[model samples]
Target: MSANLESVTDTADLAQSLREVFGRAQRALREQSGRFGLTPSQAEALGYVLRDGPLTITALAKRQSVRSQSMGATVGVLLEQELVTVTPDPSDGRQKVVTVTEKARALVAKGRNARTDWFAKQLDTLSPGELRTLAEAQKLLGRIFP
Candidate 1:
């Protein structure tokens, strides 16, 4: 790329673009998640549990970037729904670890499958060159964040 082109790509510009794209993609995915009977927060919390396995309420709150009280409320709802369960934390007697139950796993899998199917359909509509461009963009996005 030319020096002029590089100069035009300021950090602010890149950050804004990343934020916009991420927001749009999340909104789209959340719509699909809703169809599977989950709110955005519920889906996000489930994903955190699925990816990180069992975690304490405080840890999950931190991972979700929300206050502990907020996370407690979310967890409470999840527990009431039987989507998650609390187990004794082996390392900390006072702390309980929250994990996805089989029901939550099934729900998450179904929701993820729905989102993937939607993306797959969209990808199918793209030309080979366009798909290649998206693949390259994915790499670029990873590099930008890293």
Candidate 2:
């Protein structure tokens, strides 16, 4: 095979590997969140707001790569669920900020704990050699992503 062809093939293989790895992790988290009656997107949004509260819907839309209207709808669902609260911006009454409530905070914490425990159990099933390789790959991924 040509050198360029081989290089392209290697890159594609690596990309697919990364995609599968990330997708599996996401699915696990999504499954855990679903147990709490939250969709993956809703769980993700809750986690974000829990970590960075008092964010505007527009700001969240930018972060989540959705239109403001879409994010507003998402936030509205959280609002209805009593997971978040919207208050008028102190600086601009015309604008409002979304913040997580105590209940949602507990929910996020529980979800995180569940995910961590689940992954830990899964890792325990791996052989030591496999675990070492996984750890090394994670380090490499950190460098590549960071």
Candidate 3:
């Protein structure tokens, strides 16, 4: 194989490794979110509402990358659980805007704190150099998506 071709292959392998690591991290977070009494989809929906405030059902569906019907089911469940509420949209009277409730916000905050605590404990076990490397990798990952 040519030297340049080998280098490209090596880079692809490294990117795959990074992708796997990210997937694992996401899985871990999802598992932890379940412990906080939320399904992965529900937690993700709450996260969007928290970040973006109230949104029409169609808008929330788009943000969650789910079909409107699927998002409607999720929103129904959240409403039943009292984690979210709907208000009539001012701009569009026919549409209802979904917003996270205070209870949902508290639940999300607790879940985040739990995940951060777990990550912090794990980071403490790593060597300082390892921690620094992780910090740099985080910055690199940000750039990769951005």
Candidate 4:
């Protein structure tokens, strides 16, 4: 609570720590999707498609901040793997809509379950005081993020 906010080193160290922890946590969760033979980009694209119902490659690319060609390649792999299907967009015949198949949904669900179970197991090991501290820290983070 007495930390110096004006110090450049303090800010840099805090930023580095946040990035390292977040990156590690994300990598661990992403590992759950590895068993399905999906690359990170493919997994991400499928997640967006699954969550948003259907989307065009341009939409996906824009959401992901990638070039359309890159998203198209990812979509191609998804189509070849039968994880997604593409059909003419009802609103725009010139555009194609990408949709997740049942297989992709099941895969995403299983991966999510795995990540949840893994994190829950980790959390279970925390002491009551530690858990409370983590909750307080999360609230502080929410203030910064939200």
Q: How far is candidate 1 from the true structure (C-alpha RMSD, Å)?
A: 3.4
Extract clashing residue pairs from model 2. Answer: none
| Cα deviation of 93, candidate 1, in Å | 3.1
- Candidate 4: C-alpha RMSD after superposition: 3.1
Best-matching candidate per lDDT:
4
Q: What lDDT does the true structure give each of the candidates?
A: 0.83, 0.85, 0.84, 0.90
Instruction: Single out the weakest 10-residue window by summed lDDT for candidate 1.
Output: 33-42
What are the root-mean-square deviations of the candidates from the true structure over C-alphas?
3.4, 2.7, 2.3, 3.1
lDDT of 4 at 24: 96
Q: What overall lDDT, based on C-alpha atoms, would model 4 receive against the true structure?
A: 0.90
Candidate no. 2 TM-score? 0.79
TM-scores of the candidates are: 0.74, 0.79, 0.83, 0.79
lDDT of 4 at 9: 75
Tens-digit per-residue lDDT, 37-125, candidate 4: 87878878998999998999989999999998899999999999999999998888988899999998888788889899988899999
For residue 43, give model 3's deviation from the true position in Å. 2.7
Please say which candidate is ahead in TM-score: 3 or 4: 3
Q: Estimate candidate 3's alpha-carbon lDDT, on a 0 to 1 scale.
A: 0.84
